[model samples]
Target: MVNSTTGNRKHFIYTLAATTLFISTYYLLLPVLPLYMQGMGGSKFKIGLIMGLFSASSLFLRPLAGQASDLKGPVKIMKWTILLYFITPFFYMTHSFVLVSIAQLFYGFTIGAFTISSATVITTSVPLEKVGQAIGIHSIALILAKGLAPTLGTLVHTVWGLYPLIAITVLFSFAALLVTWRLPEIKPASKPGDITFRQVLTYRMVWVCSLVLLSVTLTFGTIMTMLPLLALERNISQYSLFFTVNTLAVVATRLFTGRQDRLTQEALIAVSLLLIFLAVMLVSGSYSLITLIIAAIIYGLGYGAVYPALSTLVVLRTPSEIRGSAFGLFTAAFDIGVTLGSVWGGFSEYLGFKTIYFLASFSPVIGLICFVVFLHGENVWNKILMRNAAK
Candidate 1:
């Protein structure tokens, strides 16, 4: 039931190529955009607002877009959205916040639609049993972007300045569009959006899985914001080394353990959540640099496995008819968690880092309990209740 025929290799390659370009372009811009906004005389609040707008709009619009993909097909939505990805960057040339904001609105449409449609296409196109493997491959492309794009983006901006960086990103956007065109399109398995936005938003497991991912990401967000400050306070200069080890461990975990057929997606997720808890626990105790590194490795294993496994679980657990909407809801959950975590990181210092890290470490425990109890434990309890009633 676990390892079956992987769908189409050609489509997988195309999807990988398109996502890598799209994700890479997005990642490349992620760090550079704030600097651009700052240079344009935007205040810190304005910069935050500008950055926040992209995610805010993207987060809210996901379900609608997902439903639309179910009603329509991937090709039309993808064509327009991909074009916007190629076009949105030019608006920054105006050096105006209003224009940039508008561009970001369209950017939301670009990514939101592309996310649902591309995921739909990839999942539907693959063999029913290979969803795990397919999702793993997809996550590999994304993880690589997470691993490499920011550094590359910063390097480009540092060496050639913003305009050149913009140009390089623009090129990738266009390349993504081209690659997207080649990716085979899939119509909704459901009859023309028979599944409404309400259905997508209300899917029980999506919400549960989202909470699980959110918990882990919350911990990740905390580390990202706090670790550097923690390092500076401790006078440990090789803070960047944490990222290196973390990224490497994540990639290694995926390439190695992810390929094995020994575990189910749900089981993998459960293990990952445990790793996240341990990682944060170690990080909370880190008075020394070695603890941080060890914590990073543990967190990497958890993160690398959970991401792909959860994606596969989402696709598998949801009804095929409304899978696009399912993916949208999941995406929304993931993004909202990161955004909140980032905000939490900023506010944590007010509470003192030690207290905050301790709380963050403990927070995921709630997610673990809820996920297991609701997803599995509740089922057993229900069976017992039914037997007693029958008696």
Candidate 2:
């Protein structure tokens, strides 16, 4: 038993390390890609379209990726995913938007598989009661990459330019690939006959959690897709600070949440939606760097808490046999939200960025209301079940 516990602990750390390295490759491109697309003669909507394509493809593949992880083992799926990550960046160097766009699709394929598999590692390694804390710890990898890499990429872009940055991304992914070899091949706890994707999807808790996550990710997608150009257009200097500070706030909040047991998952999620709404409103109204920074901090705090809480809710409600499929759908919701936000932001350019942001601010409000209503209904249903049992 001690040996088993030690082995899981070691693999968990390896998963975190591998994830941080590989995911950094993607986040490193986020800030610079808009400018890269523009330099290739793409218009604002075109840039958005290209960016949206990545998530669109990812949205499509997550279910399959999840299923693959379940059947094939997450470590194997991760190895192939990292190889894809390593290969796709080379396509960006083609200097053609057509090729870059194609590369984005391939690149998009990697994240869903990588994320689903790595998340599976966490969910499987720990007990159900500790899933929330384990997920919180696991999220540090994403938070760090999302926070630090963009800033690093932007700095590199300013200094050495795009090619060098691409080289660095390739190197990081290669490193991630190497790290994956160290991970243990954890077999799924249940066999194929034990659960079905249909069962996973039919669980109301899965959809409810996924939709709530989708709501915030819409704001996330809009910001990541447009923030670089928006900052440039509005003359907001040092805009990279937004990503950096957002990272810090997220890290702080994660640490705070992981140590506490008092806050219900619903409460954490509710606070996240409210903060996201407030942050989007702030971003829409911002005229200067300081406002953006403040918005990032608030947004980070909210986002940091929500992801793990939602994951815990879903994982707790799911059986291990169907967890891969459930998480696939859960994370797919993220890509779809991002896809919609990016595409909408692009096409809505005529409405102005500020107006687009103002429109997106309402997504969280809608999410919060739905989340509460769903929980209330579920609670009522549970009570009815109890009453019937008593009779």
Candidate 3:
């Protein structure tokens, strides 16, 4: 057996490198994709449809990816998925909006496959006592990449133009593929009986957790898709600064709250959602760029904490044999939420951006309400603790 600390260090290094490269490439492409579409004479509706296609594809493919990880191992699934990072960007270079949209559909599946596998790999690789901190550190890489990628991408586009930016994105993706190639394979746990997908579906906690993730991600999807448009309407084009500040805030909070997973899971989730509520409320009312930036910072703090907390909650209850499947189901739920948010957020032109943000601001509250109603009475965490005590 590998030394626990050494294994964790290796897992952290590989996961962080992969996540950073992937997120950086993703963020670099996000602000420029619509502009590229318009340059190719694509309509607003077409752009929205194309963007929504990514999430739609992921929603359908993530469960299969998870099952594959469970059967074949995460490292194997990751190897196949990461190759798409190199392939997808070549399609973007064609400058055909429709072709690019089709490519994005495949690209989304690539993301789903790798993400679910990565989640499973990391969760299983780390010790249970260190899962929260490990995930927190891993998330910081993505947040940091997100904070920096937009500004750097915009600068590259400004200086060298669109093709060059595309090239840079492709380079980042290739680098991520290389990092993933070095990841150690996780050994699958053997069990006597097999649980079908349908049986996994029977567990109410799984669905509830999935719904909670979906709701939280919906709020994020709305903000990501609409915030730039809202900023444009307000004549504030420097929206990249909002991400920078928000990421910095998240970095700080993660450093301080790295040990929070050891605390009460319910309380952490509740506090995070409450913070998200206040941030979204502030964002909806903000007419100035500075106010919007402040809102982003607060939102980042909440966003950064919620994900790892949710993952810990899910993984803590999952059997080692089906952990990959649980993660896949979780990601599928999030993809569904993101798809709905992006598609519905696109229609905000009709209802208005303010209305959309206002409605989205209440999503976390809905999730909180659901958790309270369904999962609160017995609560999965209490049951797990009791089981461990009995052992």
Candidate 4:
């Protein structure tokens, strides 16, 4: 038991470290890319198109990535994908939106594969009883990178310029590649190609959860694509601080609720959705840094808990043989939401940021309603899963 515990701890730390490093490469560009594209003669819609391409490509790759995770060890997918991160940054040096679009596509593929594999590692390898806490802790890596790297990226861009920022991003991706080498590659229980993506998606809860995740991710996608531009327009100079504050709030909330019983999933998910709705509404009305930070805190609180809770619900009920496929479909929903959010940025040229934000705020509300109306209750969801698992 002592040895197993020690090994789990080691696996956990390695996964977190690799993820933080890998994701930081992308987050570094998240805030800077909008401004960069705008400077390069891209309009708001064009900029959004380019930005959305990242998640669009990620959305396409998720199923293949998920399947690969189930067939081979996750570590193989992780290592090769991180290498794409290292190489793809060079494409951005061309300063062409076409090339930038190409780079974004590569990035989408890399992140989709890396994240699914890393998540598979955590969900499958960890003790089943502790999956909730493990997932919550695993999320900290994303939150940490999302918080700190944008600030650092913006700072690096300000001090040095775009080329240096790209170089720094390359360095981080390489570091992630190295760390991933240390991650243990636990084999999935299923034999190679035994499970199909169709089998996973056919499960009602999987697609339902995916749609619910999509609604929230749409809000997040809009925020990621638009918030920097919004802050710039309003003269909120320290806009990156929004990410930092949001990160802290998410981390705090995850820590507090990470150990809760899975039986309370419905309540946890509903409350999380409500908090996210309120946060988006706040952003639509904010004109100052303080308001943005406040919105971040609320958004963090809601966004932080919903993902892990929803994910835990799916994985707990899934059979071990197809967990990878289910997660692949589930996370692909995230990519769709983000893609839609980015596409919404195209409409900004017509609607303007405040109006766009105001409209986007309803996404989480839709998700909440879906959860309540479609899910009906936890008992219904569980029965569905239990029946499927038996087959």
Number of colliding residue pairs in each model: 0, 0, 0, 0
lDDT of 4 by residue, 291-345 (tens): 9999999999999899888888888868877877788888899999999999996
Each prediction's TM-score versus the true structure: 0.81, 0.94, 0.90, 0.95
Clashing residue pairs in candidate 4 are none
Candidate 2 C-alpha lDDT tens digits along 1-391:
1114887888888888999998898889899999988888888999999999889988999998998888888889999998766668778888888889898999898977899999998778777667777888889788999899999999998999999999999889888888889987888656667667777766778999899989999999999899998898899999999999999999999877763343476888898899999999999988899999999999999999988888878887877878888999999999999998998789656888899999999999999999989887987766765786699
Give the candidate order by descending lDDT: 2, 4, 3, 1
The candidate, 2 or 4, that scores higher on lDDT is 2
Off by over 4 Å in 3: 1-4, 190-195, 261-263, 379-391
Residue 220, model 4: lDDT of 94
- Global CA lDDT computed for model 3: 0.76
Worst 10 residues of 2 by lDDT: 256-265
RMSD of each candidate relative to the true structure: 4.5, 2.8, 3.7, 2.3
**At residue 164, what lDDT does model 1 achieve?**
85
**After superposition, candidate 1 runs with Cα above 4 Å error:** 1-7, 34-50, 91-105, 201-203, 221-244, 257-263, 280-295, 348-358, 377-391
Pairwise lDDT winner, candidates 3 and 4: 4
lDDT of each: 0.71, 0.87, 0.76, 0.85
Ranking by TM-score: 4, 2, 3, 1
